[model samples]
Target: MDPDGDPARRVRGHGLGLVVAPVLRDYVVVDIETVPLVGTGPEQDIREIGACRVEVAPDGRHLVAERPFHRLVRSEMVSSVWGSGLSSPSAAAVDVADPDAGLITCQAALEGLAEFCAGRPVVAHNGRLHDFVVLDAACRRHGVPALHDDRLDSLDLAHIAAPRIGIELRPNADGSMPPASRSLDDLAAWFDVADPRRERHRAVPDAELTVLLIERMLKTIAGSEPVRQLQRQILQTGRNPWARFLEPPPADGSLLDCLEADTARMADSSGLSSDPTSRIGRRAVHEAGIHARAAVRLDEASVLAPLSPGGALVTGEGRAFRAQQREMAAAVLVALADGSQRESRSSTSSAGRLAVEAPTGTGKTLAYLVPAVACAQARRRPVVVATHSKVLQDQLLTDIETYRKSIGDIRCVLLKGIANYVSVGYLDAAIEAGPEGPIEALALAIMAGWATQTATGDWDDLSISQIEAAFPPVRELRTRLSVDELREFATDQADRLCFYRCALDGISTADIVVANHAVLVTLDRVVEEASHVIIDEGHNLEDGATSALTETAGSVALTALLDCVAHAVSGAGVLRRYAAACGASPPHERVDEAHDALVQCRRALTELGSHVVDYVRGRTEVTVAEAASFGVSYRLRPGLDTGRAEFARARRAARALADHLRRLSGCLALEPPMSALGTRHWRHIESELGGAAFWSAAERAGRGVAPRPRRCLQAAVCVPRASVVEPSEAGVGRYRDIGRGCR
Candidate 1:
């Protein structure tokens, strides 16, 4: 007989189409138990076999018709403690007066069962584990493959049957029916059906109960749409319902059409306009195999698109090409060379600020790169390029390396955070010396692992766990070796960098410093002096700056500080003894200072947060004497009074910190300067505690406290050149600038 032409095979073929129809076919619920199962070896013998077959009605009435097949065999050893609860009870429980006669009866029953389920697919409750035990053991001993390969597991079916409930065959911790893993008898009661087994645990009755439970489950599931989808996944791919059904593309479909279709779908899903002229829109139309599209609203989208394509060279000569290179190196070069696109850089004084509104697929990276380098060469100042993503960071790194090789002797450096870079020297030495104890040993191992990947010298390679492993007993160890201890154990050995040293070199004086937005914002805030800065991925500027300035008073952060204090006090035991040896007071002043700051900081945060909430939602509108409502001070600007209130609390906290530092300067003294306190801490103190002088500098950078009269933040962009306007909007990039702030 042809297997494909068989009735059972024909019924399965119906699944290929997306329609559901009932078919006449029997399914068997088969289960098996193993012999010598107490041992841990892979192979085991089949001690018992059980099966019950059922037929599905066309009207969806699944009925159990056939008597079940049951078999049991004598084994050399039966573990009563473990095997007593299993399907085939212990040999002691068996009513076998004659073991030899029982073996013959069991073998005959197994043969009959196999013959009965000849062409039908068998269903089992976790059939994979049970069926494989029987199939593998029997096939090995009998020298023949056992039964069919297309068996279905009821455990999987039960999961599909109950879409909301997850599948598990184990009883719950409470010893109750765990929703989905209920026994066959309990399951039958769930559907309010009469069980023929009468609570019997024998093989034949259990199999019959399984059939009845499945019939009820199928009936319950057939009514739900979600269950139908689950059934589709089970029947089609034997995968979860979460898997998408990817339909094939239409015949004779062009790549352009696919792009258009996809773009349309994306536009719909994102709630953006599918039309090209919409405020937020994407147009993907292909011309001669080249997809010409724009994703408006995202500043980087226009520039990033073209760079993604192979063999696509971006020059500012063409419309489609010029649109993509905004802010990237290539676009920057063209803007400097071409007068028409040069006006976009009006906001920055050193060179015109290139605000490339390029869509996705536009070569924005190249646009900024070429023009920024040109501006840097023209001005003789180091151009600082900043991006948001680490991927873009690596790309810019490669770009700079390529430029150094091709575009003359220009120096560049990729500056990541110190914590991100691993210290290979420290890690290697620590591992070589080994650790003094468990914590130290764990830390050493972490450093060893970090050293292996310290190729880039970046600490971000390992997760928070790796960081903890590198510095074991992180909360306990302190004194002069605290920093050293963590550093010694850090898996971040491979990615270390001398940031301050690298910044001060003559030959190595970086012409371009590639960093992230957060790093750049920090540099801007800390460094009083300004340099030529080209903000790449500028769309993220507002959000990044806000995050840097924002403070959150969360319990976790509060708890961490408390833990730090606890660790410091605990670790001070050794420090106190050392101070005693030198005839000095304990360093309790640091704890006192931190405690005072915490109390004031907490109070300030609570008061300031309420004020900010009011400012964000409050309306300042009022009716004028002329019986007409006049709008005044509608919104808060950078220098607005309301905005100032939002930051008033943080400012007070900052001032308190500065005052605490003054007190520290007068009282706190170190014995030979704790080696744990690095230059970074001192620098932070010097900058943060320097008072009103820093606030004046910050005010100049549009970062001062918001003032009363100017209640809204307004920015004006002035470009000196008429030709700098993008071709899409001719004359829009001219010498004049316009902007207004509204509430």
Candidate 2:
């Protein structure tokens, strides 16, 4: 009832009256508001604790009582770090005391919240890391007892629940906008569960809204069989959720192993030697596979049966199949068979290419997956299913899991790039180095908690983006703490321990392999062997491929590279420092030349960035005209022309940058950061263009390449389609005539 009793909560033209609702079960939801305070140092202080305890009637259709608890804690300190993004709470909503109504201290607020919760399991959106961490830290500072032990993270729970309840949180079709996935506000809007307060960045409103949203989700999946398992998963999460990640995965035997044996048996029956090592046997198997796939009738495939309304999918999964899904599935089936018929081999992206314009709810995943798996089984080889994101990759694996029994159990495995796995060596080094700041400290703690519990040790499995959303700096920790030496992947005996090799080893036996587009484009052995491929998010294919193939350097990144070179030349780098300590000086004139190039590189980068910005403005204006609240995306279209003079100036600066690279290449390998840019920037600088690309690059560079500033953005060097050629040895087949192949 006391919606605005706390003057500390800035309304900011947002609030609404309460709308009471029922819950699926009796539960309590709590939200806490915190602001940085200059206590012993820059630490957070809880200014408010708002909680809602909901009880449903025996019928489970109505509410008993929806009790709300709110408290405003006194803020005695006026000093704190303003730079922290969290200080908006401090600046806008300071709880100052008045003679009429003085605010209570944080200790008093906690005690009151404990009494209000009264042994009910407390829930919060991102409570495990965000809310509970703040509370535990504050309790330690105040010497107060911990109030709650059993907690559920609505953030993690919502993700687990979304698919179980058939909610689609994937990106839009073109994928220009990322999903507004996990925020309490976004979730409320999606679930049609609104906070009447319409308020946020507050305690109780968020807590109340969290309860309504979760109740709605739980109710939607209540009749399903996974609800109990979902409930169990929801309970086990928060801080260290025990996932036996490193434990031996159960044998996911191939779904088509019997079929393979059957093919071998067929070869033997035909009086051909069944050994794969024999030429006759190899020919027999290949011909048999081709005939088997050719014989597959698209409309009657067993894989598609599981995706039908009157089929096992509906009978078992509680989800009805749509007609659009069947159409797409048949189309993919036709495309895969067509690719098998083609004389010229094509890249997985281009092979049997048919763009099905599937909107969000088209159930396109199952459409492609079932067909892809069927094709793989028919061919007796793996079918690679590629997605642009970990979200879809995870969803693909889940879909396979959901329909595995109905479709006849299939062996599938997820494979990510080596850099995605954590390096135990790097992690130990990071732990020994300790945290430089509070965010780093928190990030390390979260990583440590996840490291021991995670089986995959892959960044995506950890859902790193969630942690990074809370702390932006956490993104850097992926590589900073990921596998330090990728060469360790060469052999099992390699020193540094990482999980990527283990993941890769599973691919050989897998019937269907799920992977992100980045890994697929990188030309893994899986792509070479995969007889059929399904790119689910093909709209993002061009961009992902371009990003995988290009390297960009910005002024900030260029400056970092320069600093590395300078350190090496100035006897300050690791190698030079050792020489300096041994009383050996570096080459004097060569050192001076290196330093001068470093300075010139900085100047040229600044100049290039300025002129380049002016050049890119009016070339058909391909970027979105509407301003994004999130941020603007600037796409640099290829073949745009600037004035010859302007082009020369920019080109001169670029030439200077290229020259600087040549000089720095000799500077003790530019330490590591210069080489350590990222997988995208894997040093195409000195790489060979193999005669064909050199001329193509020269032609494209003449058209004036545009580089965006301070971003790892690529300069589009698109050439005439006819001029480009793929190496014959390249495992991927060339789409000589994509216009013929593409729909």
Q: After aligning candidate 2 to the native by TM-score, how far in Å is the CA of 382 from where it should be?
A: 1.7
| Tens-digit lDDT track of model 1 for 1-743 | 22223432221211133322223356777766565544644355555667877776546555776566667755534344444644345554663555554653334545666787877777776555555555556565645546676565554434434312113221111122224334455455545675564646555666766776776665544442321422332332222211111111112111122223443444355543222111100121111113222212212223334433331343233534443343344445433332442433322222444455667866555556654555544444446777775567767765554444434444345555333443333333223222333344333333332222222334332322322433435322211111111122323212122212222221123346666676676544212222356667788887766654432222223223323222333432222322322334344445355445444544443333333333332333232321123222222344454236655643454344334323433222333235323333232222222211232222322221111100110010111111111111111111111121110
Off by over 4 Å in 2: 1-303, 316-318, 327-362, 374-380, 405-408, 417-419, 423-425, 428-442, 463-474, 481-489, 492-497, 537-543, 556-604, 610-643, 646-656, 670-743
lDDT value for candidate 1?
0.39
**What TM-score against the true fold does each predicted structure earn?**
0.33, 0.46
What is residue 266's positional error in candidate 2, in angstroms? 39
Q: Kindly list the per-residue Cα lDDT of model 2 for residues 285-377, writing each as its tens digit.
A: 243333432234334445567766687765644477788888777777767765544333322334467777878788877788777776666
Q: Which residue ranges in model 1 land beyond 4 Å of their true spot? A: 1-331, 336-351, 370-381, 389-395, 398-411, 416-437, 444-458, 461-497, 503-508, 524-532, 550-554, 568-743
lDDT of 2 at 619: 30
The per-candidate count of clashes, in order, stands at 59, 3
